[model samples]
Target: MNVVKRQIDLKRMFTCTTFADRVRFLIELAVTAPSTHNSQPWRFVITQESCRLWFEPKKQLKEADPSSRDLFISLGCVLENFVVAAQYYGMYKEVRLHMKENFVAEVFLYDRAAAHQEEYRSLCESILKRYNARGLFERTNIHEATLKRIEDIAQKYTEQGVRLQVVQNSTDIKNVAELTAKGIRIARSKPLFRKEFAQWFRTNLSKKQDGIPGYAVGLPLLPSFIAPFLMRYCSLAKVLVRKNTESILTAPAVCVIESDTDSPETWLQVGRLAERVMLECYAHDLATSIYVAAIEMDNMSQELAQTLELRGRPQFLFTCGVPLTNHRKFTPRLSVDLVLK
Candidate 1:
């Protein structure tokens, strides 16, 4: 399951007494966007006219995402949120994506952000409310009408080569579930990979602002605490492998988001598209849980690409289903002060 990053007391930020305050407000919203393992792998520098967004190299999930796919994708999600928030706040955003050292994307916010009006109102509203719903989802099939609407929302802004495919056929779903299980086995077999993966699981909310807290990922508080200690055992992961496959099959539908190539730009597109799909799902009262580790496995990913008939590289896999519960808790983020330069 996913949760909103804890919000900063923006009473201080909303004053807009200065242009910096205005920029800060939008950055606050942008960081609320999701990241792999709640890594929060980004930083920003704000000027009166624009916001320079950068990826934190130290924040990269090197072990889990050596190719840095999840890293850039997470940044892309943040950029989308920043754009939407800027639009709603009345600032025209000219975003330029490039690579310079640790930089990912930069936005020049013009005062003339045209009125978004009703176009993205619902999607923006779903921003804070959207969490990774990772638990059991109802087995009821998603309506055909809902599928069409979701397809309509999945459209991309550029020809930079990104695509979203939904899987519903029982055979296709089984293929995805089995592939995900195989990916898990491949990763869990390694002792170092398991060790690095366990470090990201924050046992309690009070422990750290970033990283996946146990409960937010569906581990109850007690298991959350014990997870770290038991995470070293390969046997523990084996026991839970069945749970992953079974849960994935329960989704009403699974979304496979891919890009034409594996580059910062394409991964960024994947991130933006993934968030768009998630927000659309949220508007329809569907919950989403992103599965990245399995997608990171090359063999499993190739099988997924062939199974889904995706012309491009598959970067993300997530499920959408009716939620069994209304999860109010949110995964936390580092405070704005820490994220801002």
Candidate 2:
């Protein structure tokens, strides 16, 4: 029902009979971009000439992301969607990135819609179809051609310091899984961390527009409500460590996206590269689930870089393979009116 409402609202907003402004149309796609814990920490100020994207810093998961790296990364995903939607719609956007508090970027729009829709149609379609696959991925390995295609997409980023490293062999996967397990154990043991993380789990559909829903993660409605309490009081070190380790170990492959420097701008670039690859995954008929433990914990993220000899800061790691299911409901998004500044 929530998904239907969102899709209906989008149809109404973008119909040709409506105003059909590029900024508004692009925003409809922008909000679909994923964020850590589904925080959706973004607001937009739409003017006649431009749409300014501001970061909502309070939405930052301080416990899970103390450096706020993931916050800007999430904003980057929004920005990436904005850019893609703009190009797809035949509009040229001028973006200015400002890595400060609640002030990310201002995107000036050009009225001319895409002259050649055919050129952008592939990724354009991917925008609507792309989703994060969180369930167990199929045991099959991804085809080499698809992997290279996605790598090509990441390579196209060409921005300074950002690079994508793909891990496929069993040995490397095992090493990463072990490090991630350690991080999970340490992260779950901290009361403050679990407490902060718990606030984002929404069991009731009507309750919140953002946050990871219980059903989305395969948890029943009632038990999910108690997750916060358990995270704070109970020791989840064993369960999380076990589950996270097994998932990584059994997955066919993992992707590590990293940057040479650990700065807001670099992380933002990481977001763009990450989204491009994620969208490309959909284009290749594959699935991706972000595994942040290797990058969320400072020590583990550092160790991961060393393990891969990346010579950079690791920002994200995730499983990639054939999806077990494709019937994923779109996560809810706050209304456009609510996010407008």
Candidate 3:
């Protein structure tokens, strides 16, 4: 399918005459959730009144995320989108998390009037509009009200032991930026890591349905084609470190998402919280860029938690602000038919 048609399909809310059709429509929104490297590491089995979500082990990033932490977190993003879309249509019943089974989550559906339907409907709209903003951000601090609103959204997840900490102080932000630069350098030093990451980088004109396109990161046609080769064989660590550090410093604030525990279930919850926060930011005309290298590495994560005086384990990190340039080109997604079981 072409880009325009795919966008329309994702944005359209099809009228459904059956429960299965409703579930399928919701899955269209669910797949729009971001994944590490656009791996889209998930599968779904649709039924008459429910949908089962499973983690696809084959899509796991072995060198980049060997513990499957990011994979489970990616699944959490899928769950959040599915539930948000369901509530918009008044078809969400409840969702049960499965730890011991092959499926990670099973969402039950029922046809009825939904509470806060308008609220969720707005968020559902954001599912299609939201994108990972990259490059330099505007050099202005976020409004106090906007920051409070984001904090309130994060507060809702506190009982679940997930917290979102926003760092705006110049000193703290600079410290975090240094840690991020150091972490990226360490991660890229490994040959296996570079090779694994290269496999997901695609040229701008390529037609692959899943993977990060060159344009999404401001790469031109020629550079996009050579990105994989450069990443695998070239020592671009110093350049990457400088670029990432500058980007972090330019942002208004650095947000850190933490969980009280480290498990698949908590990781899922963190993912949900992270996605909701991103949507909320986009709703306010703000852009967010996720930077997880510091949080993904154990030593870096430990140092980050200490620097921020955080009480829980940090699961995700990102920067949010007005963007110097808007990123309209979206990363590709695997079709619902391709991901269905």
* Top-scoring candidate (lDDT): 3
Q: Which candidate wins on TM-score? A: 3
lDDT of each residue in 40-97, candidate 3, tens digit only = 9999998766899998879989989988889888898889989888888778889998
Q: On residues 57-135, what C-alpha lDDT tens digit does candidate 2 reach at each position?
A: 6787878988888888888888888887787666655788876666888888775553545666666566776666666
How well does candidate 3 score on lDDT at residue 55? 83
What range of 10 consecutive residues in model 3 has the weakest lDDT sum? 1-10
TM-score of each: 0.91, 0.91, 0.94
Clash pairs detected, candidate 2: 89-114, 90-113, 90-114
Q: Which stretches of candidate 1 lie over 4 Å from their true place?
A: 1-15, 112-116
Instruction: Score each candidate by Cα lDDT.
Output: 0.78, 0.76, 0.84
Candidate 3 off by > 4 Å: 1-6, 9-11, 112-116
Question: In model 3, what are the clashing residue pairs, if there are any?
Answer: none
Supply the TM-score for candidate 1: 0.91
In order of lDDT, best first, we have: 3, 1, 2
- State the displacement of the C-alpha of residue 144, model 2, in Å, after optimal TM-score superposition: 2.0
Model 2 TM-score, all chains together: 0.91
Better of 2 and 3 by lDDT: 3
